[model samples]
Target: MLAKFLPGARGAVLPLAILLLVVIMVVPIPAALLDIFFVTNIAISLAVLMVALNARKPLDFSAFPTVLLFTTLFRLGLNVASTRIVLVHGHEGEAAAGHVIEAFGNFLIGGDYVVGIFVFAILMIINLIVVTKGAGRVSEVSARFTLDALPGKQMAIDADLNAGLLTPDEAKARRVEVTTEADFYGSMDGSSKFVKGDAVAAMLILAANVIGGLILGPVSHGLTIAEAARAYILLAIGDALVAQLPALMLSIAAAAIVTRVSSDKDLAGQIGSQFGSPRTWTPVAGILTLLGVMPGMPHLLLLSGAAVAGFAAWKLHQIERRPPPPAPVAAVEPADQSRIGYEDVSDGMLVRLDIGYGLVPLVDERKGAPLMGRITGVRRQLSKELGFVVPQVRVVDDINLAPYTYRLVVGGVVVGEDQVSPDEMLALDTGQAVGSLRGKTAKDPTFGLDATWIAPGDADAATGAGFLVVDPGTVVATHLNHALGQNAADLLGPDEVQALLDGLKERNPQVVASLTPQPLALTTLTQILRGLLAEGISLREFRRIASAISIAAQKSPHAEDIVELIRPDLGSLIVQKLCGVREPLRVMTLEGQLEGLLGQAARADTSGRHVIEPDLGRRIVDAITRAAQPLIAEAKPFALVVQPAIRIAIRKLVKTCLPDTPVLSFFEVPEDKAVEVVAVIGASQPAQAGHFQPQALPA
Candidate 1:
């Protein structure tokens, strides 16, 4: 009860007293001056009140009497200065030099009064700064206030609910609890609370001033006891209390308006949105202008302006608080109701219906499903109208036929469709699965070669005869047929052969270099050829032996021999074409022997024989030249064809030797005919190089 009336009542009382004083001021000269005095007094009082309220600590009054006495002295000094200036100079002209000097002296004597008023104004500005900076602090203060008061408010609400002050639903509705935004102004620093407390403090200050003046006015200023007492009471009431009332009212009104506006959720959001706009600050400017223009009672104008600004802000918030219309309710349907399936629709079928979000899956299903011929016809018709391709049809069932059951999958999960309509199942045309199987058939060398050389088949059944497993050297020799255009023996001399033998011996000397008992270093043999060519050996010999070694490596059962024989000569170009020889530089070592041979041959005569060791050199050169003839002849037409064949044969031979180990084939044969083609080529080629290119055969 006290909180409700105190603020408003205090607001009204001061204004009324000021009005009475204004009336009295019109009666005489001294009274008119009283108006100015009252205004300054009020301004000072309000400033002090604001400072006290905004301060971090509570006001201390232990020395209040001394402060009051000092304030009295200050006011008296100011009054003397004013009187001297007015009396000595008069309104129209400058006073005598002596009189002006005396007035200046009086002004100096009254300096304390002027300083006090300036100090009060400075305090008010400080208060404003504190409120602005400590916005969070203000909120904390408000929260504390609310918490202290909540229990009583909650109890009141509970009592109302129990007393049937509301219906069951209304009681359950619960009071709309206030949040920080609702309780505090957007300032967030608790400025509203500070303002409220300042207004109350202003009223108390006014009351104190009135009482103090009445008691002390006679002693300080020259006046009769009764007149002094009357003047003091009037000064206190009119200047302090009366002038401050409007400011208090404005502060309370502003706080209430802000609270109400913020209580509306939509309004609060609008305030946030509009806060950045230029229009939001217009009210603040207007209020400040009013405060500046208004004289003695400026606090009234300032407070009124604040109140109006708050009200205007509330109005702005209201504009954004329009009620939204309720959403239209959807009609419920029975669970057993039949719905058309997407698959049942013809290819060209046009569908239009009101459906829920759940129905989208069915539409997607229809788009993916295969369509039958009848459905295809429908699709064509629809396509003509829609100017788009209709879904193709693949299968259809007449009414008398048994229903075809198909699985429906959504997101990879399969579902069963029972009694599905023809329209539900779309027909689709997919290409023939068999036509896609076209490929080259590889030869099965195991079927024709001697069983003793071939590893036994996985099942050991007497299903067919076993064939010999081609050596890596033999496979290489066969492929060399195209590159060398001659027998492998003719291209490889005793020296070249001896070099390969030495490299193979390094790994395992026990193994012999033959088609059946493939050397352990067949891979090294190929590597040596590759190296020789890289070292400037004429490709004539290297090409033949490398190709042959590749073929042999493909079929060699011995994995190590396959690797060593091919490792040397797998130079850049050949390695790239073969696909698996990754290191071109590493393969370069294989050509070392070939390079030595060329050096030996370059020094030889037209017969291609070296000068030194004429017989042995002659034999080596002749063998190489003869072996190179077939490869050189066929290279232009069959280079691509033969190299890969050699590589394939080598891969197969390697697989046969290491029956328990895995061998990766370099040939990229088609999936269907891979085994058949490999077998045919391996069997057709002889284990000896001279068989295919007889001219290059060793004598």
Candidate 2:
């Protein structure tokens, strides 16, 4: 009843009990109460030991570290309480402190204080030197190893998640478990010190009790030196023994917890299953029988051991040979029925990779499934950069595809389709290859570079000719990566958004709560995030995005308005993808008159949107494309800098013509960045000019 607080059932009771521990040190208590508290301490320690023994793994008893500290505190408090009682009332009789301590001193130790002291010393040695020391070292090493393995385990979960072997929920749960395991070991590393200190404290308190009692018994209680020795020494050893026993149990329990390996069964079950094998006990039976026949040995004892070992081996052998219980047979179907299932009506897989018969060998596991391995790598890298887990890619062999073709479908639409010869290698010439190979040439499926489908035997020769050689599997993976990156927005939905919100809630619940179920609901947030993704924004910094939205929602109820308000906060994320921090942002600007014309048209419009006339829109698109050639020739990263109000309008116009260029509003470029105006479209240069000089930004 006193220990109900320790198990964490009634949280309010724990503080009161911890206060009581402090009270026990300073306040006096009756012998009867002391005995009851002593019994409770022993009971709690025994319970902890049994729990540790029954646990299949260390994490099963995750609270062991806290429990260890409380148990140690309780033991120390009792030591103080018992020491005071013995010093004050020792000369009274053998029962001065309590029946518990008195029983330990007189009956258990046979009324010999010297013998009791030796026994207490031995128990302390076992607890401190053997058990406590060993468990502490084990905990230190376990914590270090667990921390070191964290990164590799995290990567494996990411790989499994992206490769479609695990769902998003399972991946999240696994990540939490890995982090918890690391924390548990780290805590245990420190908790082991408590047991060691308790063992040492028990020894010091025993010495203090005996010495103090010796001084008081003779001077104040009118007892002789011999009488004082008999009373004080025995009482001190009794109090020490009572406390030392429980401390030993706790040490053993701590050792058991740290040393336990993960298994499906308890310690006893593990030991029994492993040791009861016929092969193990058969050797024991043979050794015992051989010893039983020796002349100098105890024949009767060895022969009895041989009989038990032989019987155990026989029983284990019979059990091993015993057939497993018969399983119930399933019933046959009553009739053949045609029915519609959910799977037939709806397709759950968001991305599907269709391959022709010639690509079958590349996906077959018996032949090493090289394509499957590369695809998993691509999924891992793509998921990391995109900031959300992409849905599974269902790779199916399609008969409709040509013998050498592969198709990538996102959301039931074929976004990318290409061909690769399964038995050949692709050697891409990056405008640096000196020699040519006699092979059928084609454009690279991903980069549009001139490539040749050369035989596998010619891969080395192609590399020797400065050609970048890749297998059919790498070619397919590269194309799929490109297609997925372009269509990433299609992969996100309410489920993924809710997943992001739920994950964010773990770290920043206030942001999620403020943003959702308020000015912005789930569907609204989903659409807003999808819009950003479509505009080539990554959600890797999800917390920043959510915070920006929460702040922006106060200004507008519309999703578009909220998104526009949040774009400045998302500016850094956007600029990073185009160029590094130290590099200047190369951008093309609209001519002053042309931009002024668009802004005036936007304000004069009735619907709050402006559309350029057909001839004018065509002229603008042509001019932007022509101006972009300078940066393209320099092979540098660039975007079109425009007014914020007309940014989206211009993005739609230039996207198809120059899909690689990102259109950024002026405010979206972080202020710290230096700007270089690569060109001015709609200037004096003709719309169809082959090239134009770029302008530099004014100071």
Candidate 3:
């Protein structure tokens, strides 16, 4: 039984037994001698514990030197004053001398009190910083342990779901639910630890003050200890509480502010309900202070403070154990026509778009407007090039979908779609009866017919297409800036204006069908430009020739050709302008030119040709071409490549002409049958043209 209670019992029992004996001796020491004994015991015990903890799990102690220094100063001051006062003045002396000596003694004891108070204050500060900054780190650790336990908990909810966990929506929901709950509990635990630690430290200091004063003050005949312990305790408690009150109040105030800002009713209600309870602690503290003011109630204050600390600790623990609330349900549209109204018929609102053969209400009475009329005008313009009626429409307020993609629906069911921006939507070939629409209508009560339209294919055919309706107001605002070079309000009349609504609706089909690839091409070009700039190309050089480069590269040249054309210009410019050098630099002039020359030669003739041959020339060119293809594909209209010397000059000229395309370089090598053409990309030295030295490639 002993062995079970204490692992490695034989090894540990001797030290623990010795510790108990020392603690017993130290605890019984008289108040006058207690300071040295207690301090020594504490210092020794702490050192031992620290060493053991370090052996098991080392700690980073760099953060605590300030605390250590403060404690050391207080200890030194106390010891010096105590030694001076006790040695110089005995129990008997002139009345004035006695009083002066005692005053000096009080200063010494005051130093000890200050040390305790400072230590507690430092601890509380550290705890607060950790809780705020390291909460995420704590949560990550907690999640690792808790996530493994999730499956067991989920199994208890449903047995069948356990076997097919992947397919079970409940299982996936439970995973997220468990993770969220774990995070909340972890955060609460950190807060609780900080609060409990502070409260306990405060209680300890109060106890020390009251008990120490009662026992020690009288022994020195109202001379030595005085009321130093009690006074110090009260001061520490008052200062600590006052100092921390702002932070505590701020935390609670922040929670309240968050509740007010949120549109979520449940969150607001929960915050409002919790606010009343924790808020009461403030007033309770005031009442305690009033009680402390009464004569002969110092002991009572101490006891009450201890009790409050204990209760706070318990409450914090309870909060850590409390279960999280249920997850929110997904929003669903109403099925009944009665639920539809002008108030509900706003632009930018999310709505389910259906394209089934079944009859759909042409006129929704709630909005006092006809849906068919609004869509007809948009569809007519789209049909001007390709004739057809659009089958369905769905409206939404926001467009924060995933990159390079848009959602597509057909007959109330999602079909095929591409991930691209609205501009890129125009380049894609959307099949028959498929297109996108955008615009506001008379039926839209909010923000009216000021919305952008995105469709697939020509607007002429609507019969087979599907619609994803978005807020007409937002769409008009988006498209009006593009089409009319002004805001939606400036381009269209009020929401109720039928002609304006009709015009927007007519434009919707054309807008929907305009989901072409042109926008994606532009976006791709932009990304390439950004990447080159990030690689340290100058903004002035980038802007000067980016457009021409893009136009030149659109023809899709072979990778080798692209590199040959761009590299020399870009590399030379980067070396000269950025690296601060100027000259027509040949391969022989470079410091690390040999490795590059060898690498190119080896790559051209992988069969380990000892000498450069005619075939190597072709191989080198082919390799270079292959490397340039991807760079060209990624370059934007404004992308520029800068290099050193010759390459830099070449790049500058290329940039002027092909501002929108990638620029490359060219260098000649001897032709040989054994060697295949090879390309070197990035910032590397040019291969030696006359190299024929036999050398093995590095492993």
Candidate 4:
């Protein structure tokens, strides 16, 4: 029934209420009406106080400033209405205005006008001097700081959005919230002035009523001086008290709101949780107990207070000491009686590490687990190199695996698994060990090298024997790092591509904006970037990539064509990272006979996946691996500089057998950098390319 009337009633209520307040100021009201309005004023003040106290933050009560303005207008209207009633009826008696006013005057102050005046003055002073002034100052400071921090907050939201941490809708919502917070604080700063002004208005209204009533009573109503003073003074004091009471409550509410920090809990909850610590309450109780035993102290009251505090502290301490409850085991419902739901099915982690129960200590921090920290370091390093944040490796216990085994999973597929004793160290034979130790034989998970799981004390002996020794934690971390790096292309999806564009837009916005989704779709960009990553190229030179791809994309939408076109421009970065700043680039070039054969085959094989015959492919891969052996052994970077036509084909073949070898073209060698041909793969060099002799290997 109320809902039926609410639709029509809502539109008229606010306007009519304002109109009534205006009428109260212009016209006189009866004693009964004054009593209703005064009680309403008190009720509204209490309601506002409760709401303010319950608010978790200033934004939670965003409409408070407007409400404050209306309440102040209402109070001033009441003040005007009450003053008129008191002056007009002063000669009648103290009860002439209303029972509420007469009760406040006679009952509250024992029928003494001077006492009532003094009491009203003290209340006004508390409101004006303390609460109102302090609240205004806080509001001002909060507003200024909020505005000052707006730009930084906006930038942080943009950064999160660009990093794919926040969706577009979430970013928009956060921006709106930031803007609203600044506006709310600014409004509060101005609204506090209304409260201060109201306090002043209340005091002025009281003085005017008292002096005017005293003069009007004797001159207009024919009352004696003592009688007029007594009647008018008591009425003035009562009116002042009624107005000042609500004003004081509002001042307190304003102070509470401006001082409140953002929190999930209300005032009472915050106080209870923050102050519940046994460590805090125990010292407080000790201080109170010591103070209670002083000679001049009131023994009974002080001792009783101390006893209550001590009991509370003890109870809190007991609660803190209680052991946490065990986690409840999930009871599986009978399959024959239960129905399957969407909740029963779930997606798996993007990257996960599952270890057996015995190896759990490798991930537990208290047990000195280093695998978790190492995985985090791997993620940080890969994020910088791969141009996207690698998702965290979710670690869990898997009862199905062997006690010393763990599996690495990517996108719910098991890519790698290994077994290692956590309490033992792996000593790897780098082909230069001078001695040997007896332990369980195994291959290194990262590089597939011969290794032995030896005792921890055997690490010194192994290292002295020229073997590289590593802990089980490093073994797992190295495997995870290599696995991620090898499959980094698979991780560069449309979301990662968009993140790259968003980051580039910050520096070169127009270039990125014009390139993405305008001429080229996000999928096309992803494919182009993934192709580059597949060849072990870093996407860190985002500006150069964006500029080159924008121009290259317009000519051909094919990812291969774009990568081929952009590679020459990014040649210096690739070469410098491999050869360093000052050293000559030591690159191995294909023999002419092999180069001619690969080029002819590449031209015939337009698809770029297949170029040489299977037999020839293996022969070429073997020859390149043989040539790169010296470079690999010396721990130096090696690249095969071939014809541009066959470079793509060679890279595809080399990536499978020799994933670390870089395949570059003559065009990709920067003109300013000097190059030295270290070895020829299939035929001897003409001796003009470099002094290093080449061994002729048939391909």
- lDDT of candidates 1 onward, in order: 0.36, 0.88, 0.36, 0.86
Error of 2 at 409 (Å): 3.8
lDDT of 1 by residue, 502-605 (tens): 43444545443342124425345544443333222333333344354646555664544454344334333333332333321111010224334534454454
Off by over 4 Å in 3: 1-71, 94-657, 668-699
TM-score per candidate, in order?
A: 0.20, 0.69, 0.22, 0.79
**lDDT by residue for model 4 over 452-521, one digit each (tens)?**
9999998999999999999999999999989888878877778667767766776788988879887888
Residue 431 of model 2: what lDDT?
A: 73
Residue 303: error of model 2 in Å?
5.7
Per-candidate Cα RMSD to the true structure, in Å, reads: 31.2, 7.0, 25.8, 5.2
Go through the candidates in order and give the clash count of each: 103, 0, 120, 0
- Of candidates 4 and 3, the better by lDDT: 4
Q: Which portions of model 4 show Cα errors greater than 4 Å?
A: 1-41, 56-113, 134-194, 208-236, 258-265, 270-346, 430-433, 498-512, 541-544, 591-610, 680-699
Full candidate order by lDDT, most accurate first: 2, 4, 3, 1
Question: What's the candidate order when arranged by decreasing TM-score?
Answer: 4, 2, 3, 1
lDDT per residue for candidate 3 within 1-699, as digits (tens), equals 355787879677656645644453333322244244324434533553343223311112211222222222333333333323322232232121133323322442343545645554664554455432353344345445655676686565343332222323454466566655555434433443443344454445445534544454456445444453434333333333322333233223222221122232344454545543534454565566666776788857655875685566456557657798788887997678666777675533221232221112223446543443444343333222111111223532223544323333332334332222332122112222244444212222122322223444423333235432443322322232122111111211222122212233344533212211232243333333333442334323432223334343554433223333443345544344321232222111112353356445545654432344435333433333444345445431122222232343333433433333333223321111122222333224445786422222221
Let me know the TM-score candidate 2 reaches against the reference structure. 0.69
lDDT of 3 at 186: 43
